[model samples]
Target chain A: MLPLRVKSMPADRKGIRVDLQLVADMIEPGTRVLDVGCGDGTLLDYLVHFRQVDGRGLELSPDGVHACISAGLPVIQGDADTDLKDYPDDAYDYVVLSQTLQAMYAPKAVLTHLLRIGRRAIISFPNFAYWRVRLYLFLWGRMPRNETLPYTWYETPNIHFCSILDFLELCREMGIVIERSHVLDSWGVPRMMGRSRFLANLFGVQAVFLLRKSG
Target chain B: MGVTERKSTGQAPTSLDGTGPIPGYHVRLGCDSPLRLDCGVELFDFPTAYQTYGRLNADKSNAVLVCHALTGDQFVADAHPVTGKPGWWEMMVGAGKVLDTDRFYVICANILGGCMGTIGPREVNPATGKAWGLSFPVITIADMVRAQAMLIDHLGIDRLFAVVGGSLGGMQVLEWAASYPQRLYTAIPIATALLHTAQNIAFHEVGRQAIMADPDWCGGDYLDQGKRPLRGLAVARMAAHITYLSESALHQKFGRKLQDRKAFTYGFDADFQVESYLRYQGSIFVDRFDANSYLYITRAMDYFDLVESHGGPTKLFRNTPVRFCIVSFTGDWLYPTPENQKIVHALNAVAANVSFAEVVSDKGHDAFLLDEPDFHRVLTGFISGAWERRQGHAAAQG
Candidate 1:
């Protein structure tokens, strides 16, 4: 037998094309993966099948669970708002929060849980510091609703929004370590994602960072 | 552990072995023999009429079990038996497709309550020398999964690559995870909820009432009368079918489309196109399905609530060490995305590994049964991913 991981990788490789390369570069073989707010099990699926990582995902929808089940993918039906406490400390190789930080009620608590439960954590989200959002606030003086934040003010699910600079500041305050970082476009094309950390406050549109708890 | 329980690998592998036999039909493995339902009803030596298009690898690590919804047969990607129509999910399962049978061993079964070639009210009871009728002991979704687990065991497969289903079939998938998490590497539940909410129960009750109200239905003894509960079952189907559609979809498809008459008919003869379409659907369904099975099955679904069964807040799987992926459709008012969201929230409470997707479609609860490209893509990706995880674990041991 070629091994289970190799057999499962090719299908997953087809879906997470761009992200697959990125995950392969970042993750080592045999790592345990926990992905919160995993949409359709895409990233976790990629990491597990392609990068030889063990995957667990948290998603809060039935249809999502259904598709996941039909595909024979493993996942849990859950929300990041309240489900973070279920994990034991230092149980995972990595905890990942991807594109979900801005929608949280308590991003800090979630990040703390990730660091506590895993050796390292990956956090990614749209940057509220994006130039379009800045222009909307600066020129139109509105809450800056665009493609990422399309819903009306009353209906938006995003209760809190933070920029890359704001998130890094929080990390610094908590004495966290940034192992690696990435930024991507809407199409998930990686660019100068972590360049100019100091100026990322005004110019960064997306951010992905690896964090570890301060010892 | 016993000699009889050993897998019969020498048996002539049929279409049920998880491979598609013909075009437009995706095949998966089915038990070469019959299954036993919790109702003490042996499927009376029935064949698990399934089709698979993929090859089961030597270690059986590529197997993915597909559970069908209510009214769904095992012919997931082939022509329908009676209607001669295309398979329900031909788009999602095929060679080189998202659920590509060429890659993974996909297995689908006609659920116990189904009108298909599986044991139901239509099948004769071995002890009684007559159809089981309403005499069949009621079955829960857990019972359905239990039966499925038996089929999986029969194949010499130690663990399923994944378990996937929609609607009632989705219920079985969830139950499989809850009751036997160790057996499945992953679970994908689409368009199903952890519980049957009050509103859903009410809808089911209405359908039931419509079935029993017919004069032909002699309480539970009408099967011997040679007149199946056709009128009642048709009406039941018609009423329940409306809930499967969204208001937006209904409005777009059949809003005030007049029948083949310029003027309104004074009599109640299906005055509108919507009315005629519904009538056609109901009448057609009655021909292919057994009415008593419908009653027993819907009752089972009505009582299904995973949280309630788990005693409260279904995060019992926090330590189960399995993964999940949940899919929902925007227009599926039957199970609704909110119900799926509730499940996700609960899994989140336990910090379990899970994923969520709300595919944008007007197909309602039936979307999972259709040619949804997005659904196929996500599912194919997830299964391979779970397999890889198992492989990595194996590698570490070496």
Candidate 2:
């Protein structure tokens, strides 16, 4: 085993992905957070170190769990599809699903569980209705393979891909309250597009939303 | 000469092997500071045998205690003094392994109720001047942790870097976290559960009964009678051994394979390879382990339930400053994954810092001791990260 040196330098939030940075910004210090599909737990680590949040993570793969644990992040090896039911209601202040909503087997059920398990939920996913994706799918009768959606039709883990408007409609039907939303370009740069929901759906390559239970 | 002189001390009517101090690596507690067992009895002059590796840095912040499982001794990273076999946990406690003796002070002790140069049923009771035997107070997992805490106090370290263990050893680790959370920075409880299940208790009962039913057992005074219940202990070991292995593993290793002969013996002899292997395991085990020790230890485990002591399972870590890594094996029915998840769920309820890993392996309950790279990888990461967190905490305090 490689000997790991404890590096005490403060987390450099500037180097984090733009969407993740935005999500991190919404979380309050000292609150409990659970990151679903927390790949290697970079966001959880950042939240713990910089935001002083009580952070936890859940990853489906053993390798990702090992990486997270090795870094001293609290992570459980579990699938979001079924493991969410085991968590107590309002167990966390914020439940995060960054860029992993599309890969879920039942996105709607998982979304409902996120709201049920946390006071607020943060979800980020590629928007299939972005101009480039729509044009690629419209021009070629194949699944779009672009900068934001890179995997091919057969090998992609994005089984339930949806547009930004589709997600809003889902929240509407499930009685979820969308407290805040953000948009990002294909390059992961923050975009000022959520001002007009329609234009954001048409132009934004990715969408992130902070949601809460309506009742 | 030493044995005869000590026998006449005339305090108790206990069996006397030898009176001149125990001959191996050990720590003796004096009568002035007796170990107060959970049973409300104060055990005096109790000796705890332990082995340590690596150097303890000046600040004494790098000490790591590795608790051994049932049938395991203090030979964590060295050759066993009795069997000449490599240490039980050499895979994860050596120089370059996850515990990494080169970087931390690693210590392993024969548990309080163990026979290997420790205060167990084989030890003479000073009060009665006799082999405690069946008279040795039944020890609980918490009692074992208390003894370890004394050892730690004796070592002069205020706090430990981490406490780690698997199976029965894992119980000790859990008890340490619950009873003395401030004494250790982190805990790694592998292939274990929050409590012993009814199924687990039933299995242990079968083994204990097997030992007690043996004629040569002499009603737990087999030592004074100059006899060992080899047959009964062997049978008990054989039965318990099956629980440590998975059905898939057993099938893959010895599925109806005949022993030495092409066909089964027409009589009541060991014909199958699995039977022969089990017989060999049982016969050799009796040579090193005492049947009475097995009874006491199994009883201790059967009585273990963290909820009973800490209120509820979820309340075990309430308001505690402990970081935990709980691991389980996919094929381990003895202490299955769901049981381990209960622990993780409890930790989560209290918002305690915890991680849970369900490793894929066919080695059953023994997987934690095997060469599963995923287990090692998880430990390596957990320990390194915990160390880093400790450093961060120290920096903040400064």
Candidate 3:
């Protein structure tokens, strides 16, 4: 067989999003990783290429799954809410679920399954309690529409939107330890959310947390 | 098993136990070992007709077995000898197509109860030197898969990279996943059901009764009596053909249009273009297909229920290492999306690596057999990704 052309991961290593790159940086090299809701598998491509990790993905939509396959990524078409229970305990080193927590049917159950399926689970979601969102509700008395949370309430797929504090509380209740965290502004630029968790919860547009079992 | 590696010799190396690498040729296996059938009968020296394309790699991990549908044959990407038409899947199994004969060793075989060169009702019985006819022991999807496993063994390959099929062929693929999960790395079952639905079985029964009612059928002994049940077989084909197509397709192609004329004849002639089309389909089918084979194969398909005797579908893939890609079409009411979804859910419950694609096509159950662009893209993407992953795994192990 001839050499395979590595796609998803470009040679320049500049294609990945900043938030995704932060998550990638936290993952150790040569580990098995599963990316839940991995759309187009861009992060997986980057991980497989640079980090030399065995990467797999679970995407719900057909287009995303096909795109991932087109990029030669081993991604399966499955829902995060219901399908996570099938995975054996600690089957992966790192299971990453980015920007898909809000749309889940049962966020807590999915988060619990994630903690059990991988040694560490990385999750990123838009914080509904951000200052801009809070002000939009306080002043206009309607659901906030922004770059990340663009959908109206009637048409929104985010059935269980949560804030950074809500997520942390659930993690605490589940006895999951937050190993690392990154906060991004509305523009996806990493902000000081890492330094002060309180201010981050109040102002950060997005939050990414690296979590593990709190033994 | 002898390893006949013909490196750069430009000839198929012959194995000591089995015939050489006969690509594009069908091998009639005289099964030295008895094949115990699901019907509790053992077939002694049954034949399995198969065709192959591309070269088997040195490691033999790139072999893909393409199972054919109820009426399909071993000609995956070649011109059918009788019909002179392009192979059934010519669009997806050629040089640059999804299966990509250039990259993988592609093998397709006529099933055990099939008429096209494989052992069927028409074949002469080794015991009595007469056509097996109704004497042929009833076979199931599992039996067909067991026969294919023997062929794979004869080819001296330990594991198949993939097993792929649609409809009844998909049943065989599922059977392979259940019976010999270790022998396959990936399984793609498209536009198929886990078992024959009541409605589907009703359809098959209607078709079967059409063949049986004909006096020419002569109690399944038409061959000895020098008779052909063309009328009955044609009727069966015509009735079953409707199920293969969707109402929307029918409406689009020939929506009450008169055949060969703008005005209706009002006679018993094929006034609607759809009738003429169905008649044409039935007439052509009888020319190439055997009536008795139709009876046996449809009976086998009707008898198919994977979970019941197999200890449920989840158990089938409980610890399976195989990955699956299940596809269903929107307009395919024969198997439907819900049927495919059931299999997908089972695989999910077992934590088996699986994917499901509900392709939007108005072509009905035959969508898998058609050249739908989305279907092609999905298949190509899945196979390519699987190949790359297999390569990565091998390289990592090294």
Candidate 4:
């Protein structure tokens, strides 16, 4: 049979968002990876092309699932909240969930499943305790809405919104090891807040963490 | 492998049996070795009518077997001989289409208990020299797959590139994956479930009862008795047709509007447009379908319980290497998204490589057959990807 031509890669290697690029950086080349809540498969395509990873995706929306599959990415139409448990233990080298943890009904349960399914879990989410968000809620006495958190209380999918400190405490309680971490400013650039959890939680607009099960 | 000899009896003269001129390719399989069916009956010297599109490459890895639905025939991308209409899945099977005959060798066969040329209740039984009718051994979905496996074997192809279908065809796809996992590289079961629900069986029962209640049915021997239970079969088709569509689709296609007249007719003479439409659908269906074949096929579907036969849902696909793409549509009430998802979950539990998509459609259970762009795109992407992966595996082995 004639060899079919593979699709050409996107010209821009740095086209993905900074947070996603950070998540991509943590993944080792040619390892099995699953991206939970993989909307449009931007991160997955990047990982497959650049990192040479065998990537799979789980997306909730029908539109998102179709879009991912249409781009030739293997994606399932499923909710991360309920679908993650179906994966076998350590099925992937890395499991990535970006910007979707706060919207989960049970963020802790999802995190547990993520860590169980992959050797390591990479998660990124907006920090509700960021100074600007805290100030906006303090000044207006209303649910803070910004570019990162772009919805009102009733309309928001971010039901279980949490601060960076809250997430760190939960990880500690669950006996999860924080392998590496990054605190991003509003522009999605990593801020230099080494060894200072208080300043990171107080100022970082978003946080990304690489975690693994405690020994 | 050498039990049955492969020979194509190309275009034999119209036989004395009630079935008309043979169409397309017909092969007489299991002549020396009979096919042992689920019902403990062995079928020998059975004929399988099939059609092929594109060309099988030298390595023969591009062959894709498309399983047709209950009423569908082997005419995957061509015009039907009897109906003169386009093939059922023409939208998804031609050049540049989702199945893309240009790149893939596509094959479809008339299923075991189907009326379109394949051996069914309408065919003559060699022992009795008459139509089998109700005497035809009760077959199941497994029986259908067993027959298809025979055809694939006779064609000199060991492993098919893919086996794809929707609805009952989808059930056959699942059966293929379960019973012959090593024979196919990828499986695409769209708008189907691992087993038939009680509601599904109930609907089939209604259609069966409608056919049996007809005075002209002659206890399933209508063919030999010089009588055709057209009305009974038409009613059965009409009732079964409703289940294949969504309530919203019905409403959208034919509301409370009257047929041919602005006002409703007091007498029961197909006044509503919906009534007339269904009546027309029923009337045309009997022209191409067989009453006894309908009964046997529906019974086969009703008896399909993968969990019962395969131990359990998750157990059915344990350690399978075949890639799966399970597709469901939002408006398909017959086999809803949740039912399809159960198959995904089962595959997931076994760590089988599977992709699933529930395409958004208001067209109901028939959405898989209709012109849904999203559905088309998903199929295109999946087939192309699976092809690429198959190539990758082949190259790696080399």
Candidate 5:
């Protein structure tokens, strides 16, 4: 019998982005996970190998889906906006949506679906009210273009960009409970904000929140 | 493990033409037992031609059946005995290709109602010892799958590792998952739909009409009359061939360039290279294919409606243990991405383990058979993953 190539975990944990590492920390080991917008499956791969989660992915780009599948990851080419409703209720223990909520056509509907399909949902997104973005827009009176939000106004895919406070307000409106949250600074380092929404919304470049639907 | 005694060693009776013995493993099934088909007909003692690559492992768990498309035979990884050309899927089924014959056992069979050394319209009816021709019972996709199941049972394989194919072959893969879910570990259906669309049936109708309209057809009994309807079969092939390719692929390959001359001859003398290419494709197809078999196979495809026979996607695949991987090509208008996504959505509804990839390619529906790197990578990944998972299960059980 030929020796099959078995994939091993990367030796360096720091190789993953800080926000994704925080998101991974929120998931329980051996849980069923579905990662929407799983580009190249880096986080999902880590979850599967390190956390032993039964992970699947839904990616929009053909290249991302191809890369994931070629690496022996289960992934499908599908849009989160339309394909999420097909999944049955509570089909997975954790459904992770990272850095893609702002680009969605309907973030509220998608959040509703995420909660409906999974027992818990871990979501991350670039904060639109970060200090640098506010400063750039206030200083130039133009749309901000930075490392996180790189695209210009005419070509940006992030149409529904929101701040940390905006996401918390939406979660409150949807009757979703934020079990845990983390705010990240511009260097992809986590900040030690303890439930300070104003400070997090004003200074945090990105945010990760673990959420569940309230009864 | 001792069930290896049933292996056939690729030997069987001569073909219909008696040109020479069929060049692969042949088995005469239903000698004492008859296969009752969906069309209310019993076929007995029929010959099934197939080819196998690699050795079935000791536990008989490494077999991956490769279902062939329309006009494709069991010659999967080797040279075709008739065409003397490379196998249709030579790009994917070789020693180290995507299918990886080195690590997996691959089997491909000429489908029932096919002309490639299989029991079809071209074969003789035992009762009258005459060419069955149009009298052969109309077989459906389920019937084809049933025949394949019998073949698997004959080989003594309790379950296959996977069953994979594209287009018509993909239809067979789906039927396998639906009809005999427990017999295969995983199923990969590429560039296919749950049912034949109305437009699909219309295109098939055109091909069938073209063949029947040929003066030499002689009511499909041309074989018995020692006459071959070459022109009609060629025309049918020409028309059907166009549906397998996209307009952009046609434009890129041939466009409006003159065949050999610098300019048009002011007459219908194969002016455009596309026309000449289609003519050549038509001419070559008739040499190796049987026209009556074409009609029977197309009818089988037209009658294929899994939802009608089984139920809705959820109902059809409810609680199925078979892992599914559905693939589609961007340029495949015949079985577009939406049609393929219907399978994924259906699987998702049941929360069944399924993966899907719409490979970015301009190769059209035939992309599955072409050398598309992304498609190959996807297949390689899915198959290896399925194998690893299966091994993991076996280890846990042991």
Candidate 6:
């Protein structure tokens, strides 16, 4: 497994309209998508309905599969860390791993799998090193208890946590080009998505990276 | 007990020392009731069962109830009792998956008129100590929905995150929205329609008639005689199963091809592979499902006309607030895309935030349950997006 290209979502931001807007722009009519770790197939369903994007997903849950199936969607019972290797090279236009990277045992391997199977990959994850999380750890010594990461340490599923700078550096080292990016706060507000990268790294916690596979 | 008598009791599952293998609630019912048929007859008791998964969150905001289709049980995410198979929707609902057991508290109950664990013709009538076969009130799909509502109420879930299902499950999801809109955050109905068309009813009628025609059906009284209408039920399953698939899928899977042979035998026996396959499907179905229960359940499906029941198509979504995701498959003729489109159109007219997708697949209505990649893409995106929206709102609040 390679080092993960991971970034944390920002803190103290609000507004869901930004994410929807980004999703609307990222996909076009008739584009094919593969959403890895899709929670319940909502975005995939929405994109397909509104943008006419043909989409598929890989989720490890039967409830999600049932929801997907009930929506007449398709999915495979595979994990991002191990199962993604089976997909043929460049089989999809976009392989998306949204809010699922943190749960993986090998985030880099998963990202590489996404890159190998699709032309471009969209990766989204909640930032664990945001200002609020940092404050909690610095002051309380207890694991962060923000709304984004709500579970206790014993039950929490987020394993691989990274900062914005760390993710950008990994992408650069891997020679992967960032085609588009969405830097959102914990509240989902886009503070510096389509603008300056330096400001995004300093303030933006939640980050969405759209990268093209270099290798 | 005699070996024959013990066989009839539906001994406990050997997997978990009678506790059963499951992630949550699991229930099993013996074939105790003599089931009654809508065609004025009866059959001995058949195994009807169900189970529940996930914990009901304290706030109950996480409770989502899943309704199964005809011949489906409450075991949506577990193993089936009689068939010894995994739950029908195990692909979508599980820990760490879309319907994350960690997030939402889920409940799945047997439908009211089902032979499953819920009260139905399969349950023994206390007064007569016999299956209520044929003598049971002819049930409608709405009745099934009503029963599900009762189960939800019993479970203390006031509002459901969503009522989601495909095929017959889809039908119930629609009914839940129309009947109890305020209690739902979302409604996901797949591979179903707003109303059962004349053609759909006619097809169900044909299947019911075929089951009733079986001599062993004994006017729905085969239970007392310890016999089953195996031939009739198998034929019924055969006919109904055909409707579940598209011509293209049939052609791709099993054309006018021969079965395990170089040439046709030219005998009355099954020479074509399709014939043999259908026969096997029919025969295996009889071992698990009861003939009379099939007739009753089909009758219930035929009576599912939400538009007609709601008084008119326009009035149905007049006050609907539940977000909807109605999906249809290109090749599903039984519950065609047009049917789902009608649902989408109605929801749109009512000013609902409804999303719909019609995926192209040759698997027909059953495609909703298969390994279709496009299907998962839309679903995974929808559910997680919903969660993200919720999380986003929380983040903005404080």
Best by DockQ: 5
> Which sections of candidate 6 miss by over 4 Å?
A1-215, B1-49, B390-398
DockQ of each candidate relative to the true complex: 0.22, 0.59, 0.34, 0.63, 0.67, 0.02
Interface RMSD values for the candidates, listed in order?
A: 5.9, 1.6, 2.6, 1.1, 0.9, 12.7
Candidate 4 wrongly placed segments (more than 4 Å): A1-13, A139-142, A191-193, B1-19
Higher-DockQ candidate among 1 and 2? 2
Query: Candidates 3 and 6: which is better by DockQ?
Result: 3
Query: Chain B vs. true chain B: TM-score for each candidate?
Result: 0.87, 0.93, 0.93, 0.96, 0.96, 0.86
Relative to the true structure, candidate 5 reaches a TM of: 0.94
**Chain A TM-scores, one per candidate?**
0.84, 0.91, 0.90, 0.92, 0.92, 0.86
| Residue pairs in candidate 5 whose N, alpha carbon or C atoms collide under 3 angstroms | B10-B25
Clashing pairs in 3: none
Instruction: Please give the CA lDDT of all the candidate structures.
Output: 0.71, 0.84, 0.82, 0.87, 0.86, 0.70
Candidate 3 lDDT over B1-398, as tens digits, reads 32222221224212111233223445545446778888898877566667788889999999999999988988888887567689998887878788988999999988898876678888788789888889998888888888899889889899999999999999999999988989999999999988999999999999999999999999999878988788999999999999999999989998988888878777999988899999999999987788888888998999988888679754667878998888889899999988887787677666677767778899999999998988888888888878888888889898
The residue ranges of model 5 lying beyond 4 angstroms of the native Cα positions read: A1-14, A186-193, B1-18
Q: What ordering of candidates by TM-score runs from best to worst?
A: 5, 4, 2, 3, 1, 6
Candidate 2 residue A11 C-alpha distance from true site, Å: 17
- Residue-level lDDT of model 4, residues A23-115, one tens digit each, is 888899999999888888888989988999989999888778888887778889998888888888988899998888987889989999999
**In candidate 4, what are the lDDT values of residues B1-398, reduced to their tens digit?**
44433323444313223356656787777876889999999999887888999999999999999999998988888887777789899999988899888888999999998877789998889899999999999999999999999999888899999999999999999999999999999999999998999999999999999999998999999989988888988999899889889999999998888889978678999999999999999998988888898999999999998878998865788989898998999999999999999889888887787889988899999999989998998888888888887998899998
- Candidate 2 structure quality by residue, lDDT tens digits, B1-398: 00111212233222223333333455565445778888898886676777888989988999999999989988787776556678888888878888888899998878988887679998777788877899999999999999888878877888999999999989899999999999999999999988999999999999999999999999999888988899999999999999999999999999989999988679979999999999999988887788999999999999999978888755678876988999999989999999888788777677678898889999888899899998898889889888988988888897
Candidate RMSDs in order: 9.1, 5.4, 6.2, 4.6, 4.4, 17.2
Stronger candidate by DockQ (1 vs 5): 5
Tens digits of per-residue lDDT, candidate 6, B59-122, equal 6667777888887767787766667788888887888766778787767776766655456665
Whichever of 2 and 3 has more lDDT, that candidate is 2
lDDT of 5 by residue, A97-181 (tens): 9888987899999999999999999998888899999999999999988777767778777789888888888988889998888
Write the residue-wise lDDT of candidate 1 on B184-292 in tens digits. 8888888999999999999889888988998787776676777677899999999888988777777898898888988788999988989998999899888766778
Poorest lDDT segment (10 consecutive residues) of candidate 6 chain A: A1-10
DockQ score, prediction 2: 0.59
lDDT of 5: 0.86
What is the Å distance of residue B218 in model 1 from its true position? 1.5
